[model samples]
Target: MTNYRNETDWERADRNIGELLQELRIAIPGVQVLFAFLLAVPFQQRFAQVTDFQQSVYFATLLLAAASTMLLILPTAFHRLTFRKQQKERMLKLSNRSTIAGLLCLSLALIGATVLVTDFLYGSEATAVVGGASAMAFMVLWLVIPLRARRLG
Candidate 1:
């Protein structure tokens, strides 16, 4: 049932850690970009013209993006803190979970931010249509596809 090459425990742990680190390298930058954009939103002149709902959506999106950034970066800190403790396996496992959680937060943040922007440009009905579609896209791409792959494989 194993689709991967068989290896010793240490080898597997090393490989997993390496893979996690590489993945973090991809995730961290994207999360930081979202965080930076969200951080700058309030300073925009049009921000003050936002309706109450839009402001709420913006804040929610910002908070989720911030949380995602923290979660995405935690694995690096966790690895550093736990280095030389002979706990690479634990680190890998925990970081994997953290990455998943971070991704979920990121998806939500993207959905809310998209909705806020779309609503600003269009209207509430347009926001609902665009946001719903965007959320579904993320859910399918991020969650459903991965889960289905794991289940089928």
Candidate 2:
């Protein structure tokens, strides 16, 4: 009970939902871009040049992107269907989990796509370096900072 939010249950739920929706808004655009890019890759001429492993990575990344997009979108659908159902608490919790799952899929998708391209253009060594850096970037920006804030706030 850290008094971080001095709101009543309903007020907190409303605020949490608002914050979650805002987070989704910020996340959705980038996910959409990644999703669209992945969708278009198979149509590109260079797509045929990728190795078997690269193709596998491509397919996995594409599926992850699609899943991420759906998970991100599910929150809104959940909200709409349950808006007046007096289940804000349950809805918020589930939506929060969905958002986290969406982010995890999006992170892996981004790393996989980046590694695939790097492996194609550079090699496996460069792909490893780039993949590590990209994962660290997400781990820091998306995860560490929030955790630090939670601890310090």
Candidate 3:
């Protein structure tokens, strides 16, 4: 890289970390809220009436949300542990991977949640259509468009 902005390595790392943290700030709360809701689902009286498939989906979605929460918050922990150790580059690399994986988990969790709700409300017939559509929307909006934009740029 040509250091187009004339920033030192440390400066670049700092900038990247700042940007990543900002992105996480936007994502963290949503995942947290979803995780909270998932945590409470089984406590609801009606939850006992869910089909086996719905139960499976619910568990998987809950796990996905938990994974997303951990991955999304990992950078902060890493930063805290590695602070002042001149590990910004490593932190940045790890944070980038963590963020991507976190977002993937979050997307899948959202899809699962949607499918679960749709199935509960309108049965498997509607769930099939709505779930597929939800998955497609997330994939296109979150993954395809960004990849395409990067390729084009």
Per residue, candidate 1 scores C-alpha lDDT tens digits across 1-153 of 243677778888888888888988888888888889999999999999999999999999999999998888888898889889998878888888999999899989989989999999998999999999998999899989989999999
Question: Please, what are the lDDT tens digits per residue for candidate 3 over residues 1-153?
Answer: 439899988788888989999999999999999999999999999999999999999999999999999999999999999889989999999999999999999999999999999999999999999999999999899999999999999
TM-scores for all candidates? 0.94, 0.91, 0.97
Better of 1 and 3 by lDDT: 3
lDDT of 1 at 20: 85
Best by TM-score: 3
Clash count (model 1, backbone only)? 0
Better of 1 and 3 by TM-score: 3
Which pairs clash in model 1?
none
lDDT, candidate 2, 44-114, per-residue tens: 99888989999999999999999999999998888798878998999888898999999999999999999
Query: Candidate 1 has what TM-score?
Result: 0.94
Q: What's each prediction's clash count?
A: 0, 0, 0
Residue 114 lDDT in model 1? 90
Candidate numbers, best lDDT first, in rank order = 3, 2, 1
Question: What order do you get sorting by TM-score, best first?
Answer: 3, 1, 2
